[model samples]
Target: MSYHNPVLLQESVDALAIKKDGVYVDVTFGGGGHSKEILKRLGGNGKLFGFDQDPDAQGNVIDDERFVLIPENFRYISRFLRFYDVRKIDGVLADLGVSSHQFDEADRGFSTRFDGDLDMRMNQKSKTSAKEIINDYSEEKLAEILFLYGELRNSRNIAKTIVGKREEEKIETSLQLRKVLQRHLPKAKEHKIIAQIFQAIRIEVNEELDVLKEFLEQIPNLLNEEGRLSVISYHSLEDRLVKRFIRTGLFSGEPVKDIFGNSNVPLQKVGKLIVPTPQEIKINNRARSAKLRIATIKH
Candidate 1:
């Protein structure tokens, strides 16, 4: 039931500007680290709702009168909250991407270091998996995910190799897929290359980017006046979306200007982007790529 220490626990909660009597949410309630901290700062009337789609995360649910864990994905934040009669919240916190516990568990196939099944669904109920994506996706489609999600430069070649190898033998496991793309893994760049490959498949399996966009689109309507949003993303793709959504209120393209030169955006950036200090990165290597962004409803 132990999950890695929630990234930016203190910094993210502090950014929420928690009101003792406020209602809040921890959307990625892995191990309940961030939710627990927010609970400590809340008054008797305060409430904290947690959401996690991973069935395994249910084991880490906290026992408290003020907390309720929603056994669902954060993308359904608005729908589930409505079931609780919660229309608007004071703050929402999301520690994006895979949890450390998921990466550490070899069977999850989230880490490149482990040799395991090609199943990378964050939710166990998910029908699509990394194995299916690698073994069934067309070369063109595979390349698209690798280039977009993995940010791999040689994505087309990597996809061609996967399609070629899977034709000979189905790529069933992590090591098997790695072997299929052996030529791409140069000695000096072995770790990075394999990681990118895995990342691309995992993102596809989970439809991560799509889920993120859906969740963010609901934030403005879900938050109360002055409500805060704190998100910690480990990759540029997620960070870029969060950054753009905060600044422009759209994932792509610029906001249209009105006759008065005013652009109507739903959210505003709270402050400068935040990243882990070198000291923190030394303690938790997972925090190395982490970037924190905060935002609030435009008023």
Candidate 2:
């Protein structure tokens, strides 16, 4: 089966403005779609390092001296790059969120459509899983996760139901857990609401927001002068961070200034945010929510 079709492919690549011999990094190399494109624009000496936490992503790796696939999380991208003996790079591209392959694989339990194990860990090596969140977390913590991460309006009731049901039998599978929390869901909007709740749980399980912050903080140290960053965030939460970081060099708050009024920051915005054209979204509805932000280190 084909790996995921990279969302906003041309838009993302073009934003990078690839140099003939520049080094680049694809922080989330789901199926190598963007990595392959980066390689195509490179000269013989150019190199591309790709990172993916999921082992399943490696199955799509291409055999090329120009490409190096790292089966690790992008949160430690700087460490891995340094270990690989790459000190600085020309650009970085991050397409965040779960891949289509993960969702399609029902056993992974990332989607609401399937009844499977409640394991949403992107990297199986990781100890924390969705099952732990649902089973081990206290009622208060569970409600917080659903409300903060999932944005479920009835988070309190859902958490209450989960805690109430798990006492009788552990919520082992997605179906079992969903059935228990069914009461909190609106009858007419069950499907979409359930999906949002699941999304929240998966975000907490993966610690995605925290990982993203760490990764973004390292970008200034990772890039050479004028090095570009092209990030495609799938939801508002992720997009807000990316936008804020690019604009102010901090996840929140205004950019800091020196006594003399000079800004103290490493990155500068390139252009207004980009979203998918209607045609692209029509073909792949998943692309609809994607927001692409581009920036470059201070030259």
Candidate 3:
């Protein structure tokens, strides 16, 4: 159950500004790293709830009276918390995207470094897998995911190639998909290109962006007054959504201002973007691209 190193371990949790007896939620409770840390800082009567859709995470759940592991997705944070007779929360933490263990486990198909099946479902029970996307999706849909999620410049050509190859033989595995686009992978940038392709498919399979939006939309209403939100995002896509949401409370367009010229937003940014230091990145390569953003409910 060695899930992940939990990037920004102290920084992200500290950003929560934990009150000894405050109730908190860890939306991505992979490995229970952050949750465990929160427990150490909680006093008597403090409660901590965690949510993780991945079955593997359940194995790493901490055995403590103060902690409750909700074996569900964070997108339904509010609903599940209500079932426990919990309404207001003092803080929430979300470590967005796939966990390190998911990528390292070849069978999961999250990493381009591994040669495994094309199964990139965050929740093992998910219906739409990376294999389905590559084998059944239309050329247009494939290209859209590649461009939007992977940010690949030649997404159209890549999608056309995948469609053309799948017509001859099913693209059932990660290596097969890579071999299909071999010509596109220049020797120098092969790994980078392939990683992008894998990322695009994984995102689509998990409906990651949609889930993130839904989870974030519920944060404001769930948090109590002066509640804090700490999020660590690995890529620009997730970071952008979080950054924009905290600043304007809207995914797009500016927040409307009153006659006094004050815009009404749900949360206010706590401080500047926090990134891993050189020491952290050296120890955990995954922390290199990580960005931590903290915000509090607007009064």
Candidate 4:
């Protein structure tokens, strides 16, 4: 089976607006689909760097002089690039969220379709895992994760049930936790509700929001004038942050305005939001939720 299929392949690459000898970064190099395409477009002098916390992706590492694989998280994109003497890049692309391989592997516990341990850390080296969050977090904290991250309407009941159940026995596996949440699961939307719960835990385990924020903050400094950022987010929360940052240079509110009343914006939105076509979504169901946003630093 394919390790992973790239989403919005052509559209995303086009968004990069690659120059023949320009430097680029593939911040979420899952199966290297986007990176491979970038390599194809690059001239002999061009270079590409990839980041993936999962060791499983190491096998997909290409052995090209211009291609370098960093088995670290993208949150450290700037630090690692500096280590490699790469101060600026012409473009960066990130396809965020759980990779297809992670969802397919039952042992990784990133999906509701399988029975496995509740460990959802993208980086195995990371200390916090879904298992810890489920088994050790306080009731209030659990409620917050469900409500804020999962966006579950029944978050209070789910949290109450989890706290009440865990006292009798530990919840270590996905199935065990699923059973606890099953009561609150909407019968009409079982698949979606469960997926949301899994997503919340996965995000928490990987510190995805924090990582994305750090990664975004570094983009302006890392990009050359007119450097582009092409990001494909799999959910509304991620998409909203990307959209806001690209438009106003901040996540929560508008960028500060000068006394002259002109709002400060670091990156200009390159194009309207892009989504996979019906044909692409038919071939890859995962593309259904994907949203592509592009922006370029003003010269």
Candidate 5:
């Protein structure tokens, strides 16, 4: 599993409060790292289902009868698990954001440091790509994605530059895009700005935020009474959704109150936020921004 080094490995799994004989899931089963650890804690009767959309992950599938790797996105977690007669789960783990392997493979076009094609589709079969977004999307649409997803304030200027540059020659590679936005990238902040731009395009191409919302919406129904949810998010956008859902059971705004003035929240936050320790961050730089949150079925 050099494909990925699961962040918050022990802390995230411990958040599951794993039951020896209960069923569980690792929704982001990259490299099967977390799933393997879950199996180690499971008894003979325990079952663990893994979900991953990337075909590359199939290579790392566990050979245990107790483990089943579903070759689909976790947005369809409930539907796929039901195909196997599983209606409830004791715990579920999610390590959000792109896998280390995806970032390392230059051809996949995930890294800002690499000069590769503009393709950034997490599911290879998906049609949309960074190339399409950069070269085909309207200037307004491009600006919107950069502003919202990338958290960039000068997105309109960047979008205009991209459109102007592509008119002469199609922006086909990461370096080409970088050159198009040269004025925007100051030497001191070049890496941070480019990362934000890449993140913006990747999120839009993969519909990551939408998929996350859909997957989380099913958690209330998929979990058994007191079932645990352990999630590790690398960025603020994803973490906000998880935190809001766990607190209010809704992605936005306050929860509605019933006749008795009791809010109908479904999941209860289990503990304070968990971030990578200095020791862990030193060992794995990817863990630097990782934030782990745990929740369980609300009483």
Candidate 6:
């Protein structure tokens, strides 16, 4: 299967406003789809750096001398870039959330269609996995993640159900966990509820929200003057952070204003929120929930 079909390919890259010889970064270089597009827009002197913590993505690394793939999480983007003496970058593109490749691989435990071990770590090297979260997390902790990340209203009850079931046998696989929560799944909303449960565990196991926040905090310092940031977030939690940061340069609370009421924000939104066209969604169902937000460093 194809590693991943790039979503909003032209739109996201165009938002970067690529400079021929400018430096760029694709932070979520899952299948190198967006990275390849960025390379096409670059001249001989142009350089591109890609970051992916997943060992699976290493095989897809571009062979071009001008391209470099850093096998590390983008939360450490600044620190890693500094190692290459890259002090400032012209643009950065991020396609956040799990990749299609990850979802299609049943053993990786990302999709509801398949029965596999409960492992959803973006970087397989990570210590925590969905199996651990399902089998070991406190009911309260599980409920909190379900409520916050998955936005499930009956999170406490669902978490309670899992806890009750696991006491008899450890929930080691996706199917096992799904069966345990069968009560919560009416035929009408079974898939949706299970997906939400999986998403909650996946987020906790990978610390996705925290990692995203860390990565966003580094962008203002990493970009050159007028440097562009194009991020495609797959869900509301991720999109909200990107949107608020671009508007106020902070995740929460209003930006501080001067006596005259002028606020000093680091990044400004480039345009209105962008989403996949119906045609694009038809081609790639995963693109249905994708939201692309563009921003540039404030002058």
Cα lDDT for residue 128, candidate 1: 95
lDDT of 3: 0.93
Q: Model 5: residues >4 Å from true position, as ranges?
A: none
Error of 1 at 205 (Å): 0.8
lDDT of 6 by residue, 116-194 (tens): 9999999888899998888888999999999999999999999899899889989898888888888899999998888
Clashing pairs in 4: none
Q: lDDT of each structure? A: 0.92, 0.90, 0.93, 0.91, 0.94, 0.94
In candidate 1, residue 164 scores what lDDT? 88
Which residue ranges in model 2 land beyond 4 Å of their true spot?
none
- Per-residue lDDT of 1-299 in model 3, one digit per residue for the tens? 26789999999999999999999999999999999999999998999999999998889989999999999988899999999999999999999988989989999888888899999988988798999999999999999999999999999999999999999999998988889999999999999899889888888988888989998999999898889999999889999999999999999999999999999899989989999999999998888999999999898
Error of 1 at 94 (Å): 0.4
2 or 6: which has the higher TM-score? 6
**All candidates' TM-scores?**
0.98, 0.97, 0.98, 0.98, 0.99, 0.99
Lowest lDDT sum, 10 consecutive residues, model 6, at: 173-182
Question: So what's the TM-score on candidate 6?
Answer: 0.99
Candidate RMSDs in Å, in order, are: 1.0, 1.2, 1.0, 1.0, 0.7, 0.8
Q: Model 4 misses residue 57 by how many Å?
A: 0.6
Backbone collisions counted per model: 0, 0, 0, 0, 0, 0
- Clash pairs, model 6 backbone: none
- For residues 95-167, could you state the per-residue lDDT of candidate 4 as single tens digits? 9998899999999989898999899989898899898998898988988888888998888888899889999
Total residue pair clashes for candidate 2: 0
* Cα deviation of 18, candidate 4, in Å: 0.8
- Model 5: per-residue Cα lDDT over 2-33, one tens digit each: 88988889999999998999999999998999
Positional deviation of residue 171's Cα in model 4 after best superposition, in angstroms:
0.8
Q: Could you tell me which residue pairs clash in candidate 2? A: none
